[model samples]
Target chain A: MLFRNILFFMGESWKNLFRNGWMSLASIGVVAVTLFILSVFVLINMNVHHLTEVIEQDVEIALYIDEEATSDEREQLVENLRNHPEIKKADFVSKEEGLERLRDQLGEENGLLEGYENPEDNPLRDAYEISMHDPEAVSSVAREIETYPAVGGVEFGEDVVENLFDFTGVLQVTVMGLMVALALTATFLISHTIRLTVMLRKREITIMKYVGATNWFIRWPFLFEGFNLGLLGTVIPLVGIYFGYESVLQWIDANLKFFPSLIPLETAMGQVIILVVPLGMALGIIGSLISMGRYLKV
Target chain B: MIEAVNVTKKYNDGNQALKKVSFLIDRGEFVFLVGQSGAGKSTLFKMIIKELVPTSGTLKVFGRDVSRLRGKEVSVLRRNIGIVFQDFRLLEEKTVYDNIAFAMRASGASPREMRKRIPQVLEQVGLKKKVYSRVNELSGGELQRAGIARAISNRPAMIVADEPTGNLDPQTSMDIIKLLRNINVKGTTVLVATHDQQIVDELKKRVIYLEEGRIVGDQEKGAYVRAL
Candidate 1:
């Protein structure tokens, strides 16, 4: 009996959808447009998070060791830096290796500083590059490292790190705020549109009530109608995101080699698919449920 | 069977629709509810279906206190009683067969049952040939007959026809009363609320007459009485 009722509701929902083609189309269109806009924001949110990770990698403290210090002293300083609570990693870079890295960067201009090529003649000092778990903790960790005996001087971009933290905090808050607002707006619009379909068939609903239909019996078809509308709304946006994002990633990969940290379309789309389809359907269901709640008083 | 004891309905705007009105309708009984516009006939019908609760006193239908029924229980209560409106309330877009089938569908009747029963009820209402005809295309008399078919399709214990003949001519009205009379003969209780005094005189059925929300006259085989 329950199964038959469900089948009947589903059949009725399908009939109503086709019977009111224009209204159904209009409802689906609303969901599609709203979900498309939401997907775009989700894409932007992923890229922003990716950018934050990339910039976080650059937030390291550079400490120059005293040139006269012994190799044992340098190793002890590296050990102390690593054992610090805030520091995630601490690695020693010899003066010779630093010069080699500089030369590699200079390429053809390596010969411009010919006399300084020798290890003994190299002006660079041995340094301990420190990476911390929290970007905000970098400054405090650097201050602690400065008190070490063999440390010559400590340098890290204080203003740049502070600004990065502020920017990331504000961006995260704004994106989250926008997402919640958009979700609510989408739910509201979809529900109101579905309500139009309910209003059109109110007479039928009343007749059903008069004939002793359970409230759930009357609501099942409407809920299914909402689910169908929500499902249909996601199709275009999913296609756009899957294909459109892939092409954008392909173009970026070809033209912008420097931005290797940007999330690839495949990875981004995995999240999008999981998020978009369910969100669209949920919004659709929520909208329909809200409208139906009013009429189900019968 | 239905019982009403000291039933009073007071709207939020302070208009007392029914004041200390009480009556009993036994099983297999045909009753006529005759009243003017504000004489509380509609309110009484609504209370019987559990649509509106009486502000005071008790109403019991089928041995259950109707005022206490809630949600699904109310639907359960309504299923045993069928109602017909003056306007027919047929879905104009649907055919006569679909309209009758829809009523059975509401109560979770199987498709096989609907198929078997729709034609039978249509035949009873003398619209078996017009089964596939759309409600909008049917004559007023045929439409009322369709409404009757839908109401009796479920075989409820009682049938309430509120001014069923109000929109029809005298000959058609008599035809509808005869149809209701036939259903009553089959032992399903029937109640007809109407202002047509000529039919009341002709049929000589049990009549409960009301004025100003009070029952002034109730007589078996009664005529429509007007106080000078």
Candidate 2:
């Protein structure tokens, strides 16, 4: 653990890492591919989460007012809806707007709505449309609004809102599950690559043991190799992520506008770098320990 | 110093590699453990280093029972006994200087100490001219010399060379044995296990002869007698 021992172990590991050209290269490549797979899933998970958030925003309740209610009472209802803790947004639709929307819907059939053109004759009532920050609370919020004397009825299609929440929750959980499995796969994949290098130098380890090296002394160099392989392997994919991810986002923005807008490059990359780089290093260390376990007994 | 009293090693397959073999090697003595293949010289050497614990009876190195040494204590025991192998066993990819430095580093020598001590070790073994040559690039004699340099770099109290000149030519063998003898003269106890009758007879040091996992002869300044 001293600085001197660390320096020597690092120097020894650096040489052993390249001792077998193909074996070392192969280990690095395996780490890269496994990490790259994990990153792709992470990006997918982030985008899906973003899309679900956008959909949740559109899940609002339409509360029509009783025509018999006074203007002051309608105004008070709008204010209360807006001030509620869970409410994210509220919009008041005047009776005239209600008529206007009906007219637009009946475009080709204008003659049928000719009598209803006047605001007084319009059948639609003034309504307040409100959405909650958490879509899961839609039904409870709708039920609470229904208790208002001035409010006619609340309609937010209970089944659709519940189903949307269910679908998004399942998607997020599945993606997270996949990420855990991928991380484990990356560890084993990296370990297998490191094992080859360990075998190539198995004789060297025995000689080290014969030379009176402590188990730690023999382990330090291989640990260094494992750590380096993982770190270097991450660089390939991170470089792939850093320079290419933004351009991929731009391409999606131009060609697939209907798709949910992906998280901004800077934010997505921050999340990925924090999670993946350490993952790579951890995988490397674990891999090295696994590969070295049987050999260090001498 | 090593002491063995009724030491026996039985493998899992019930084959006894050593049968109550006992001997005492005092400090600063040169001894040749001479035996044929399968005669248990290797097993006895391994027991001294605590690599293989005795199945029965007691074996002590440095006055402590080796069979009772724990993990870290085993390393301490080994560090006190420098071992040489028939194959030279130097890391093929490393230079001679680095090979000896490995031994010093294993024994926790400081960087400054290693730098100061390596050249001296190389000089003692006559490996100074090829100090930077990779092990694979050296001739058989030079490799053996580098191995010896590494074995003595840590200044262990005893040197256990298991067939040190096993793979060398007759002349190289003689030279390696002479170097070991010189190190012994400098007060480092030396134990060499060899089948070479010429070196054993020529040196006429304390010889312990083994046959079929049993010590048949032990004598002061003994010749390579096959227990006649």
lDDT tens readout by residue for model 1, A1-298: 3887878788987877787787778778777876776787678777766776666677788999887778788778867876788988888798898888878655666785589966779989888788888888877888888998789999886665457568767776886777677667666765666677688788888888888888888888888888888888899888988787888778876655445456877788888889889988898799788878765556
Write one digit per residue (lDDT tens) for candidate 2, span A153-234: 7888567545656875787687677756766665676566667667777777776676677889878888888899889889
Q: Backbone clash tally for model 1?
A: 1
DockQ of every candidate structure: 0.63, 0.49
Interface RMSD of 2: 1.5
- Per-residue lDDT, model 2, residue A260, is 55
**Global Cα lDDT for candidate 2:** 0.83
For model 1 the local lDDT of residue B196 reads 88
Instruction: Going through the candidates in order, state the TM-score of chain A alone for each one.
Output: 0.62, 0.61
Over B1-228, each residue of candidate 1 has an lDDT whose tens digit, in order, gives 989899999999999999888889999998999999999999999999988999999999999998889889988877888889999999999999998888888976788999999999988989999999999999999999999999998889999999999999999999998999999999999999999887788888899988888888789888877433
* Candidate 2 residue runs with Cα over 4 Å from true position: A20-37, A40-164, A172-181, A236-264, B226-228
